[model samples]
Target: MSTYQDADAWVAMADRTRRSIVERLAHRPMAVGELAADLPVSRPAVSQHLKVLKRAGLVCDRAEGTRRVYQLEPAGLAAMRDELDRFWLRALDGFKELVEDEGDPP
Candidate 1:
């Protein structure tokens, strides 16, 4: 039960590494070491990225036998999706109006 801000989720995903992390987590929850091994970065770098993701509410972690496994936060992602949907709707509405008005005499 976490409160996620759509803006933070958008900003957090702006980084390539963070986006990659999210992609990995989308498939399965993983430990920091596992992610680091797959990525081109070090374990410490992965940990730092996880910290940012956690703060942005894009990911959450749980301790399991001395390891913290990270997974994607659906709630945060849903918020982001809603925001993007709204943006696209507004853009399309404006475009529709502009196209319709083109046939009118200025």
Candidate 2:
């Protein structure tokens, strides 16, 4: 997918509650109840945030018996990381060029 579409991952994680949910899922897969237990939000609210995360491809869920378990989606996480790396690389390259230009005797 294009980086623009992948940008959705950033938008999805912009909310503090959603970020909290993502952080929790990073440690281990969790059911909605398990996730909500640690957060101030209600279970239904957590579920709503999960839906947004799922839509952004930042998370996936599977049925574990009677409950739905959620976990970070590697592909989506990797895409966001890769994009961040690219951004940093470009910034560094620009700085390097600026430094080199400044060092030239004129």
Candidate 3:
């Protein structure tokens, strides 16, 4: 298990290419070759993205023969999602209060 600061998770996912790779893995585990086939980047670029995701704790890998397969590290992603949800909840509550305050005195 690894701990990722909330802000960094957002940043790691900020890039469109990285997000696309992550989203595809969210569906199922895939070998690097398969990932490259589906992506616009070359295999080496995909490898580099995997390295970033690995360090961020958002992804993990295993070896099956010569292939290295990658998948979402659910535990890390769950933590990230929880943090995002909490942020949204707080923002929404503030929005609700602001909207209410703009109306006649409560």
Local lDDT at 60 for model 3: 93
Give the per-residue lDDT of model 3 (tens digit) for 5-59.
5556677788888899999998899998899999999999999888888777789
TM-score of each: 0.89, 0.94, 0.86
lDDT of 1 at 17: 97
Give lDDT tens digits, candidate 2, residues 1-106: 4666597789998999999999999999999999999999999999999999999999999999999999999999999999889999999999999999999999
Best by lDDT: 2
Give the Cα error of residue 21 in candidate 2, in Å: 0.8
Clashes of each: 0, 0, 0
Model 1 lDDT per residue over 1-101, tens place = 23345666777899999999999999999999999999999999999999988888889999999999999989888878877899999999999999999
Candidate structures ordered by lDDT, highest first: 2, 1, 3
- Compare the candidates by TM-score and give the number of the best one: 2
Ten-residue stretch with the least lDDT total in model 3: 1-10
Q: Give the deviation of candidate 2 from the true structure as CA RMSD.
A: 1.1
Candidate 2, which ten residues in sequence have the lowest lDDT sum? 1-10
